[model samples]
Target: MSGTTLLINLAGSIALLLWGTHMISSALLRGFGTQLRQWLGQNLTNRWMALACGIGITGVLQSSTAVSLMATSFTAAGTLSLAPALAVMLGANIGSTLVVQLLSFDISIVTPLVLLVGFIVFRLRDDSRFESLGCALIGLGLMLLALRMLGATLGDVEGSAIFQLLMRSLDGELLLALLVATVLAWVCHSSVAVVLLIASLAGAGLLSPSTSMALVLGVNIGGALPSLVNAGSSVARRLPLGNFLVRLSGVLMLLPWVPLLAQPQLLGQLPPALLVVGVHSAFSLVLALLFIGLTAPLAALLTRLLPEPERVVDPGMPLYLDESGLEVANIGLANAAREALRMADMLSSMLSRVLQLLRTSEQANADEVRRIDQSLDLLSAAIRAYLADIGKEGISDQDADRSQEILMFVINLEHAGDILSTSLAQLAARRLRRGEHFSAFELGTLYPLHREVLESLSLAVTVFLREDLPTAHQLVNRKEVVRRLEAMASREHFRTLREDKSAWAESGDIFQRLLRDYRRVHHHIAALAYPALERAGERDINGGLVGDGLADAPDTIDRKEPEQCAS
Candidate 1:
């Protein structure tokens, strides 16, 4: 064959190989990413089991790189822990070796047959996954068939004088042989291809068995380049994964004599391809066994060394909703999601308490308010972190909607806490500075109403959680009455504010603060009514279904001049 023809075939074969690998990887990801994540998270009840699962998963996938990348993505998203990911990384190493072994077999004899069948299925698009899978198989078959042709092409040129001269220089220098092999394999992003090239060269008599085996060592070392480089750019805890690569590859090459047994006479009779696969897998497994047990100590060290990574507010944490973590058990999956929701609720509750504390005139109250505000902020941060984790998990459409809604609700709750703490609390403080307290009669009129309004809000939340349609319906009817009563109480207080200018000057700020907070809390409660209605399959309460019963509501709070004091 001409040089041009050889080059074209090689390029075409290489492209098809890369493309096929990509398609298969994506299908595996799309079909199983979330299930995979959930399984990793909740299913790894023990370290040994985690290691086993990791190995099994990676072995099945045929790409340790894929497993590592998936684990890195999960760690960054906050869904996966460093230990579990490390466990998978170990398994992935073993899994990746499986690919080389498969390639080593004489599957090429049947390659054309598989390719023919694959093409027939590929054209059938009704089952898109099947079609994709068919195309992938065809691509694989073509790459294999290309290897045979390339093997023949090289064999034709092997006994030539020029080839003999070239072989003399490369044969003796193991490092040189290793370097060339590494570069070529790195270029292809495939150690399997590297091993194939080695096998073909040895088979064609282009290179001696010893030299070909030396190149296999280089192939394994080269495999680490992509993953090691990627690890540098990964999250802090995942640096160890890259470290695993550097250690594995470096150790194998440094101690090659023990493992490679790279003798030309020995290499000549053995299946060089199978040797490549075995050595590569064993090298990784050795590394995993040596290091996987050290996962916890390593994690602790990384934590101690790296410090806490700075978190940003933008692209929130990815939940373990991806295919990696979710394959364990259905109950475990639901538990993780619900825990995320519960965290959100806890944040909302804590934030509410902080806001309530902020609404005070006493200096003592102010101190407590500030402390609670800081606590609320911390809770918000924690909830946000948990949300990032849940986002990484595989979610059903309904779960996705619920997850987003819960996140949004927490954000709103956080802001509400901020407003109350900063604005309402300050007003309360200023009123107390004047030494006036809630008037006895004013308390009598407003306190019971406030209690009743809060009780109603409590009832609404309970009904929503329980999915009680009747209770929700009844709560809808009472909201109007609560609004009327709130308005009436506001008037009675306003009348008191009007009666005594001196009193207004003294406690005006406190009175206004209380009224504003009372109204704002009521508004939040009112807003929750809709969610309750939604739970019950009712129309939006804010829409016409509730009618104009509360239509005369003051769009804005009435800030009119005070009148005669009722108190």
Candidate 2:
């Protein structure tokens, strides 16, 4: 083959290899992501267990980067401690090499059979699990086929003058080879693919043993870069940074010994393919053994290096929404859900301060409430945009529903915040300007109602997060309690107004307005229950179950309740 044609074929094989790796990673994530995360979270009791868990998970997923991201997110959320998280990263490095070891052998004979079964299983439309498995199988087949094609393509150019010159140059400049391989791995986002490509080059007699070993070390270093760059917070970045440090240290220790280790008496007795993969595998294994016990101290070092930033309140910017997560539906949905919960917390805080504002009419308190409300608005917009950016193509039905559910919850929260900042805050300001306070009786009536609203807010958050049917029932029931309390307070105000018309008129007006706004806020909060109840097969707004005959009828619950409450 001509040099140009050889280059094209080589590039195509490499691209195929990268694409196959992505398919396997994405498919596994879609199929069993929740279980993987839960398992990773539950088993992180100590460093040894965390190490085993990481090895098992990365072996299954065949992508250390995926494991790294998972560990980083857990660390960020405080689900996994820094020490255990470091251990997981160490195991992940070794797990990645295990995949390389398996792929380095001659398994092209099974490629056709794997692809056939994968295609058949993938065509089974009713079972998502089977479909995901099939996709993973197909990805595996493609990777094997690509490796075969790579060997063939390189063999055609193995004797070319230009290829020989390039290989000779890399043999002289080991650092240059390392740099090129590092860029390839970083850009491809798969060290496995890069190492496999190097193994193929070595097997094809296109690269010296030292050059292949140097490339392997480069891939090890490059594998850790993507997670560090994409991490969302300082805490999240630590695991990846620590992993990078470990790999860099290993490479530094081994760089000067490459020629010695690659000699015929040492590692060169094995076949070229085995030599390349053995070095890769042994390097990671040594690192894991050396650093596994030191994970705690390493974690401490990382913590000092990437210390948590002081908690500056940037309320308008989202703290949990991760843009990189949008590439994976599950991760994106998770990010949106976390941000929605944050919005709920902000709403709860605003509600708690509303009563204080009414009592004291303090300008500072009112400003804080307004600021939180503005932050809510910004977060609402950010979440909506983030969810919208998650591409619909390839997302499962469940994830799409979850995305919608989070969007609805945040919208309700934003509406409730508006009631606090706009309607209630203004009433408090009016009372302050007039140099009047709520009467003792008015405060007495309002206090219980405010307390109930706060309780209901808490319940609403619970329902939003858990979607528990019983809790949904209870939240919907609280709506009636809030309504009755508001009515009773209004009646009492009217009675006081009748006794002294001119004396009670202004305060009565403000009191009734406060009750109306509070009830409206409660309405938005209560709206959270309807969707949950509906999902549980309750057809009525009051959380009553109905038969299938009634299921098709227009929703008795106001799907647009939050927007109505806002209006």
Candidate 3:
């Protein structure tokens, strides 16, 4: 092949490597992002666990940059402490070299077989996760095939004058060589690809071991660029910045010794490709060992540098809805889910305050109810706007369903807030203004029903967060219990009005209105569970009929009540 053709082939091989790495990373995230995130959260009790989590997660993702982004996002959300996050980065750096180590071996023979199996699995599987797993397998196969092709192309020029001239030029200028490799890595958005390319070149005798080692140093530093540039918040930037600094320090410490270590008689006894891979792995391990102890102080410095900004009171802003995440569907959906959770929290506060207002006559409590009501309105509006801006083109059909679920869930909560604030708040205020004291029997009837509604609201929020099907079905059943309580309470109130006018004069109107509104609130809360129930096919979403899947389903209760008590 001509020099130009060989060069083109090499370039194509590099692109292939990058494409393969992207496939692996994106697939891993789509398949296991939530589970990995939960595992990381559960294990990050200390620096050591954090380090282990980072290593294990990065090894699975096959991309340290992805792990860094995950850590940085958690830090920004305040779900993770900075010190442990920094430790995770240290371990992630070490985990990234595993790809290089695997690629250095002679696994090219299995490429076709892997690709065949991947294609079959992808073609046969209907689930997104399974399909994504197939995609990952295909990507790995492509990477191996690209490595073989790259090696063949580079070997063709082993004795050429151009190759000799290029090597001679890079032989003395190690820093210049490092710059080239670093730029390549940054542009590719993958240090694994860059390291693999350098190893292939070294194995083919197109580049010496010393040159490859210098390039590996560049790869380490360049690997951090993507995370740093992508981080929109200071909290997100701190973890990646700390990671880069650790790598920079390690590189500086090893710079003077590169030449000494590169001498064939000293440390080059292994094959050229193996030496390059070994050096990359050793450098990462060194970074982890040297910096693990200093993570706390390092985190402190980072915290001092990027101190959490005083939270601005933007009631209209969506706290977790990051626009940058919209480019990646899973991440954007996760952000939307978190924002939905925040809304649920506000709704929970509103419910608690409503319950408080029912039991107390404090002016401060009434004011808090009004204040939280307004906040809920602002938060709900912000959530809708945030969801509107998220593009649907990239997300899977399942994610589209999730987005709809969040939208509907938030809308239900907002409606429930309006009920509590407008209807329930008004009745409570009227009762307090009248200076009325309820009889012991009346108070007894209201308290139990109120507590049950509160419990349903809490459980509904749980169903929203967890999508627990069994609990969702139970929540639907609880809706029936609430209906009975409302009916019974209304019937007792009417009997009191007929039999004991003096007692009725004190709390009758307020008590009736409160029961009606509380039942309305329960209806809204129970509505949140219907989506889950519908997804499980336990209920027909449109007709409100229970599905045949239930072997011993409860008989559907008639929910109609007396006209005066109707919500």
Candidate 4:
């Protein structure tokens, strides 16, 4: 074949290899992502277990970059500590080398059978797990086929004068070869692909063993770039940065030894392809052994270097919504949920102060409540935008439902904050302006009702997170308790008004408004239980239909009676 044809064939084969790797990663993540994440999360008690967990996950995912992202997110969320996270990165490096080892052998004979089975399973299966498995098998077949094609294409150009000259020039210029390979790996975003291509070129006599070893070192360094580039917060970036440093250190330590190790006497009977793969494997193994025990110290150093930035005092800015998490559906959903919980917390703060504000009628308390409501508004908008950016592609049906649940929860919290800030705070301020105070009987009735709403807000948060059936039933039950409290308070107010018209008449309207606002706030808090109950196929909670009884309207507080309040 001509030189142009050979280059084109080589490019096509490399592209196919990259595509196959992507197929395996994406398919496995879609099928078993939650399981894998749980496994990784639950096993990080120590360095050894974390190291083993990383190896197993990276091997299954077929891409260390994916594993790196997972580890980074765990650390960023404060779920996993820095030491174990670094150890996982070390194991991920070794796991990637194992993939290269498996592909280095001649397994081309099984390629066709694998492809046939994969196509049948993928096309015929209705189950999503089966489809993901079949898709992964097909990717495996494509990888095998691409490697075979890559070797054959390089073989045809092995005898070309121009190829021979280029190989000869790289033989003496180890640094130049290393630089070239680093660029290739970084641009391709897969060290496995770049290393496989190098092994093929060495197998075809287009690269010397020493030059191939140098390229392998560079590939390791380049593999760490994508995670570093894509990381969002300093906490997220630390793992990738530490992984990069480890690879860079190994390269510097191994660069001088590459030529010595690749000498004919030392290389003995090993084929060039196996020799190149061995160098990659040995480098990773050495790094793992050296750095595994030092992870804690390294983590401390990294913490000092990448100190968490000073937090701004603005409560409006989102703390948990990391933009980088959006690339993974599960991570993005977790981020949105955490932000929703933050909104819930802010609403709780506003509610807790309501009774105090009403009792004291202080301007300071009212101002603080309004400020928290404004913060809730800002956080609600941020979370909505973040969920929208998570998008529909690659997200499972369950995750899409979860995204909606979070959005609904956030909307309700925002509505509750509005009631606290505008209606309740204004009523408190009006009482202060008119020098009106709740009588002993009025405070007695209002205190219990306010307390019930606070306890229900706590239950709402629990129901939102766990979606526990029993908890959902409990939360829905409280809705009835709140209704009875509101009705009793109304009856007592009328009784007081009739018994002493002048003493109660002036403040009676404000007191009644306070009772209605508290009930409305409880309704919004109780709305969280509806989705959980609906999912459990329990349409009725205490004789009330799920998602009924309340207005169910976003941000609207109806002034209707308790009977009409059933949404």
Candidate 5:
């Protein structure tokens, strides 16, 4: 083969390999990404367990980069700590070497057969799981095929002058070899692919033992680059950077003596292909053993290197709306739900302040309520914009419903915040200014109503998070009780007004408005439960209660029959 053709062939084969690796990662993630993330979250209790989890997940996914990205995001989200994440990265590095070990053996004969089966399954089965399985199979077949092509392209030019010169430059200068290998792995985004390529070259006698070992070390360092580049926070970058530091330290410490080991005595006694993979695995094993016991100090050093930012006193932004998850529908939905939960929590805070304002008026509490309302507005806008950015093409039907539910929940929460900031907050400010305190009876009624609304908001948020059906039913029923309480409170206020004109003039208007605003806020809270109720097929016609097909009383807190209100 001519030099130009050989270069083109090699480039094309590498591209094919990259495409295959991407296909495998994306397919596995689409099918089981939630479970994998859950496993990482549930299992990473300590360094060793985290290391084991990292190894297992990487082994199953066949991509350390994927594992690293996950650990980084979790740490960014505060779900996984830096120390455990670092342990996982070490395990992932070791897990990645398994791919190289498997690829070293001859399995090219099954490539065509796997391709045929994958094509048939992908064409015939329309299920997402089966489709993903087929895509993974096809990707595996293509990866094997790309490896074969790479070997063929290099084998043809083994004795060419250009090839000899290229070999000579890397042979004498291990540092240059290390740089080349690092760049190749970084660009390809797969250390396994790059290491396998090195092993192939070593196997074909186009590279020496020491040169291959240097390249392997470079590949390990390069493997850490993608996660670092992709990380958006200090917490996310710390673990990957630590992993890179460990690998770099190991490689540099061993660099001077790699030539000594390659002197046909220590490591050179093994076959060339085994030597490459064995060295790769051994280096990772050594790193794992050394760093596994030092995770505490390592974590402390990383903390000192990358300190956490000071916590905001009054956070006004979305905490979990990660843009990276937009391409993955389930992950994006989970992020949206979390942001929605934050909004609900803010609403609860506002309601609590409203209750406190009713009992004891304070300028600071009123000011805090206003600030929280502003925060709620900002968060609502962020979540709406985030949901808009998520592409609808890939979202499953359930996720589409979830997206709509999140949008509706945030909208209702925003409306509820407006009720507090405008209606309730102004009333409290007026009361504080005029030195008007609610009557003892009025306070008694308002306290229960406020407490119920706060509790319902919490439950609605829970339903949004977990979609718990029974809890949702109880929330819907509680709305009716709040209505009755409001109506009874209104009746007592009017009865007092009739009995004494003094009470009516002193507290009548504030009493009526308070009841109206609290009931309105409750309405918004109750509305949040509707989506869950509808999904469970338990929505009532007029009452909006979650029960079998019985029409409810007209949805009104307007004074019920006096006995019914009392009930």
Candidate 6:
């Protein structure tokens, strides 16, 4: 009867644990996903911040593996930089320790209360904040309840002859236990689950201390292996996986060095289960501390494992992600996507400047513009090729989608750059052919307007990146200013044509051509503004343009929505 009772409890606990964790993890992921992507785009200020974000994500999700895989895939996609991804992976190792800490404590008492409160909120909207809160609470409650039940069941079955024989059967065969643990972790697709199993067995005194330690080691190593396999051909991804294994190496080595299964620390004060988890997490912390200062050097080595990037290695990641960046776990993909986005931003900014230069017609300025244009082309081609190479690994569906979007965005902007690059020299030639061109006042109106349009471009890219709805809305008013100013200038030109028609009768063809060229330049600037404004979701900026048969556009941006104001 006791054996049957224990079996029932174990089954129930496992079911509850899995369900709760699933619920909470889903909620936390949804709540933070876009913001996480934003952070990935920005890539935290430095390595430490990346690590902290990784830890925070794993702590909330209760799964280090999830964070690591996400970061790794992002690295492959060229979204996140390699170094920050590695740093975050390191922090994820720390955050996953929280689960062990929780399981060590007595949490069964409040499980019922948590479930009751959580159920009350779960009925809310699927994406509502309250619904997410309920999911987290319920998941926590269920996991705690499971741990309590497992402890009770194990305590009841502790003295079973069958159990004792089975555990003692593996006595000194630590290698076998490690292999078993690794296989179990891979099969279950969760190291945390394996940890729980080992914890329960140890608590029942069914497994010896050395065997339990080996099991812990196996669980850690196995948890990271799947992602490594998934990385396939991505050097950026492989580097971080290598870093994780190397960090795990310290723990693996330490286990064999640990003394006496019968000692006080091993069995008397610290139970086998506590020792198992404590050893794994403690060693991770130690490894991080040991290697924290060595990050730059380690990063260089890991990065060296990959193909050399086209750009020179500066603190800036013009080419690839650092391995230290992806080690944190699930945050990998988002961070990598962000890096790709940043490169795209730089390219867009360069294109805008090229357009501004085209509006001017000086020989020196034209030459400078040519150099900048070549640089933009080289960088854009490099980034696009980089994203393509990175995407071959098993990146997540979302990240793959993001890659496609980013590629499309950059390609369109690149076309615009190409347009401007060739036009500048021609504009300069036309001015020289016409001989000093117009009055100083005419150049003043034209040049200042061109500069302002280019200056305004800085704001549009800022709005797209920041997702600032208010700023995006402000762009509409600014566009209006551009429109009226452009109209006023055209009117002034027509007046010049009427009043000075006789003086420039021979330059008649130049007048019409110049007017058409200038108007087209303004039209391109106005076109760039639509993407930023539409992303804000304020008004259909391009709906009017589209209705007038200008361009085919999507109703919503793939990853953004500005509720109330903007994210």
Arranged by lDDT, best first: 4, 5, 2, 3, 6, 1
Per-candidate local distance difference test: 0.56, 0.79, 0.75, 0.80, 0.79, 0.60
Which RMSD values do the candidates have, in order? 10.0, 11.1, 13.0, 10.7, 10.2, 16.2
Q: Write the per-residue lDDT of candidate 1 for residues 402-492, one digit (tens) a residue.
A: 5454554445445545655676566655655666555555445445445544455565556535646566555556666556656676676
Q: 2 or 6, which is superior by lDDT? A: 2
1 or 5, which is superior by lDDT?
5
Give the TM-score ranking, best first: 2, 4, 5, 1, 3, 6
Tens-digit lDDT track for model 2 on 1-567? 787897788788867866776677678667766565566567786788988888886876567876786677768866578898888888898899887777566666788988898899999787878888899889878866776776676557656787667766898578998887787677656787678777877887878888889989999988898888888888888989999999999999999999898888988778888888889889998999999889989989999999999988777788777545776899888888888888888887786676667668588878889999999999999999989978645688788777778888989889989999998888877887788887777777777667667777788888888888777777777777777777777887787788875774666688789889988988988888777777676766654645322112121222221221121
Tally clashing residue pairs in candidate 5: 0
How far out, in Å, is residue 169 in model 6?
Answer: 3.0
Better of 5 and 6 by lDDT: 5
| TM-scores for candidates 1 onward, in order | 0.54, 0.58, 0.52, 0.57, 0.57, 0.45
TM-score of 1: 0.54
Judged by whole-model lDDT over C-alpha atoms, candidate 4 comes out at 0.80
Task: For candidate 1, give the lDDT of residue 170.
Answer: 88
What candidate 5 gets wrong by more than 4 Å, as runs, is: 1-34, 44-81, 109-160, 196-208, 268-274, 308-567
Report the C-alpha displacement of residue 125, candidate 1, in angstroms. 8.9
**In angstroms, how far off is 530's CA in candidate 1?**
9.7
lDDT of 4 by residue, 1-567 (tens): 887898788788767766776677678667766565565567786899988877886776556766786678768867578899999989999999887776566656788988898888888869887899889889878866776776677567656787668766888689998887787677656677678778877887778878888888889988898779878988789999999999999899889987888788897258988888888888888999999999999999999999999876778788878654777889999989988988887887787666667667578888899999999999999999999989845688888888888988999989989998999888877887787776667777777777777778888888999998777777777777778778878887898788885764647788888889999999988888888877777786564665544322222222232221121
TM-score, model 2 to reference:
0.58
